[model samples]
Target chain A: MRRLCVHTITTKPLSLEECLVEFPKRGVSGITIWRQALEGRDLGAVARQTREAGLDVVSLCRGGFFPAATATGRQAAIDDNLKAIEQAHAIGAPLIVLVCGAVPGQPLVESRKQITDGIAAVLPAAEKAGVKLAIEPLHPMYADDRSAVNTMRQAHEICDALGSPKSVGIAVDVYHVWWDPELKEQIDHAGKTGRLHAFHICDWRTPTIDLLNDRGLMGEGCINIREISDWVDATGFTGHREVEIFSNRLWSGDQREFLEKIAASYAQLYA
Target chain B: MRRLCVHTITTKPLSLEECLVEFPKRGVSGITIWRQALEGRDLGAVARQTREAGLDVVSLCRGGFFPAATATGRQAAIDDNLKAIEQAHAIGAPLIVLVCGAVPGQPLVESRKQITDGIAAVLPAAEKAGVKLAIEPLHPMYADDRSAVNTMRQAHEICDALGSPKSVGIAVDVYHVWWDPELKEQIDHAGKTGRLHAFHICDWRTPTIDLLNDRGLMGEGCINIREISDWVDATGFTGHREVEIFSNRLWSGDQREFLEKIAASYAQLYA
Candidate 1:
């Protein structure tokens, strides 16, 4: 079955409660809530409402951004990630998505080492809390200031070094990895290794305005989402296809209308 | 010894003859002329003036855009590349930079294969004309409408398969490959293989507005231009770091002022 997951970023203007209500109303199978939306709200109440509404918590928004200029900053990030793990566990979320951080005032090699160390520091806490950590490899464009883990091969190598298939895996986001020449091969490798943890869907707009926002809706851009989804499905992982678009245009639209468009887009491709 | 090369796109508003005259006045060591500027100009006169002005024609930009839906379109592209090779030879340029085409009407995979095949088809003419075909792997943002060849590894693989080290190589643009995870490794590989042909320099703005025209001037954006140039230099591949920014802001400025800015920017970084 093609399970649909609503990433809260698609309807970021709405509150977590509003997003939760909107998801079920739009016929989404699950919801992936961002940590930002959970801010200033009762965590237990939001979690309870999600459960009461019978919405499947696919995965938590994120918990990685590890690279930091100072030791204090690094430690603070780790502490924050620990809290994120606890939040995921509280909400009955299966995985805590990690956007492994990038070059901090040091060379890339040193930054990569720090990323690994940061992940290792949080592994034990996440393990104890029964939360799977999904390391999301962002597009290489974000390697400088965003995430250093920019390739599946690199992420898999990190997982291998850690020596725990259950503790660490990867989230395959098409927006980030669609342009990779080795994407298909890496996806196959991830599938064979059972390291494919989450699936993300979005498009690369032709005239991308902003590096952070300006992401296209699934079918609006050139990425063949259906082909990539088929590859993910071939991995024998039937997880939800989370619509994780960070588009300013979409965000400004009516929340209900946006949800309806997402459903329509998903149906056009996956259904 | 460091050399100076003016990318014609810098003076895109000027006529080709006017552009040629500007290079000598600016005290530039060489010029990299684009095909668009050469479209209706007299090739013989342009070539003659290039020599008369004592300008070393470093490279010709460009001749690839190979992905097309029809066989006739592909053939037309091949013929056009042949003409470009002739033009490069006439102008005394050592390299004809090939922006290997993108997906015609299909997904990236199919487009990538066409790009490789297109290059393979054109290599003989390039070799015959004594013109080295430098495959400029554009940023992945261009993988859809511009160039499917989006990585150094992919470009190197095509060069390797073609089996003529002198006939095919790559033009490393900082704006394109600055974000690559395996950039250093690929640069080293290109160096070892004698495939580092031409080096183009530009910066990627954080909030890139237009996919094509929003490139930042060096030192303005997040790209570590010095580090990337150091890698290129380490390869023992002695080539001019050609300034190739496509900026609306710069283009709209006074032509002489724009030239002065580029010269100053180059001096700060390279001199």
Candidate 2:
């Protein structure tokens, strides 16, 4: 419970203000803020209020979509990522998760090259702002149009390509990576290289209806969450086991119930 | 087009009889028979009819669900697979493709071990029947409940574990292995090892709506089918370039039209 964090997008129905008020009440120790939830809000005040409620700002939800069809499109992504870095600084989030982008028809190797370049371009901004960037390797299902970095090895390679910059690392998300046979080895490598920056939890539903938003709660699906968490913890990672689910089913429900369910899942799987 | 083959399920609405008559007419030189398409038919007669229609029997569509929670279930799978070997022999399909199974909640490692054992058990019958078993590595999206074998490397490992038998090899499906970063290297290894039994081609739709049935025709989606086919060709694989798709949208339309589209796509891409 002490290591539990909940991403604001997990309960998409809840506002950041609502989360700042309710997350602490539910014994959630940390909150990772998605940019959308900061819509028309004072970033500094949200940070201050979250802190006042005794919640640590876990990380900013996302800040990468670096691969694009054109140089202009790629530049635009870099500009947006720069803005995200500034936002993360204002919100007192020490890290930003990256869903490194891919173009639909582009070769993944090229997309990956672009992703490495994009991260390098944004690294200076992140370093200057003291906001670490975590590349979240998405499932290969998203390898077409989402992140080209669909494995921890690919993310690690990108970080390695960028010269193992202290500001860049990998985010291990179980929903995306639990199916990987190389998961434990890669997780071990990430930890050994000090590149395992974050751990996100959710389950891969057996009949995952939607590719993007059908993530199941911890116990609802078959992911070996406890084992993966143990691996993360074995690395001496005392960071938040962030609950970062994107589920239309759970989001449509009462967010209090969902948050409580997340807490219960965290307690069962981690505590 | 001379090297072109199509799986029966690629046009799910078509009966085996319809495909037998239609595929050769469309200049698809071969037909891969799905077990479901053979219901209530005389296997020998179908084989004769397929040959009489000037179509070579490429392979049997599938014969594996090799992992189960219960020993009884696992035995049942092996038994059914043995029957599939007999059927493939009876149908003159010299090969049987295996979509190795996974139990949802079972640890994948355990499931993989069971998969290896199950294949070993079925190997004797396959050898006796003179029907080769091609281990088809399903996409990782299916790794939860559909297949524990989700990469060529895993399939190769299983083959190696079984002492690299001549009776067992790999079925490379582009739709399944396209996103794999190790695809080209693994394919090269498979070819050099003489384990490349079959090559399957299908387009992966951008917003792949359904995990099971939302495959696209060649030009309809993002997969580099020609490039993958070229890699297979580079290995001197003169065997059929099999078009295997499962599209509900295409199935709901006129199947003849769909078949024509497949033909056009093949000619445009491969010819």
| RMSD to truth, every model | 2.3, 0.9
The DockQ of predicted model 1 stands at 0.42
Tens-digit lDDT track for model 1 on B74-164?
8898889888889988777889998888752377777777777888887887888899988888887777788888889888877877774
| Docking model 2 quality class | high
List lDDT for all candidates, in order: 0.83, 0.91
lDDT of 1 by residue, A23-43 (tens): 887789888988987878777
Pairs in clash, predicted candidate 2? none
User: Could you tell me the TM-score of chain A in candidate 2?
Assistant: 0.98
TM-scores, in order shown?
0.93, 0.99
On lDDT, the candidate that comes out on top is: 2
Error of 1 at A77 (Å): 1.7
Q: What lDDT does candidate 1 reach at residue A264?
A: 89
Q: Which stretches of candidate 2 lie over 4 Å from their true place?
A: none
Candidate 1, A234: how far from true, in Å? 2.1
TM-score of 2: 0.99
lDDT of 2 by residue, B1-271 (tens): 8889999998888888899878887889999999999999999899899989899899997988889999999999999998899899999999999999999989999999998999999898899889999999999899999898989999999999999999899999999999999999999999999999999998988888888889988988888888988888898788998999888888999988888888998999966
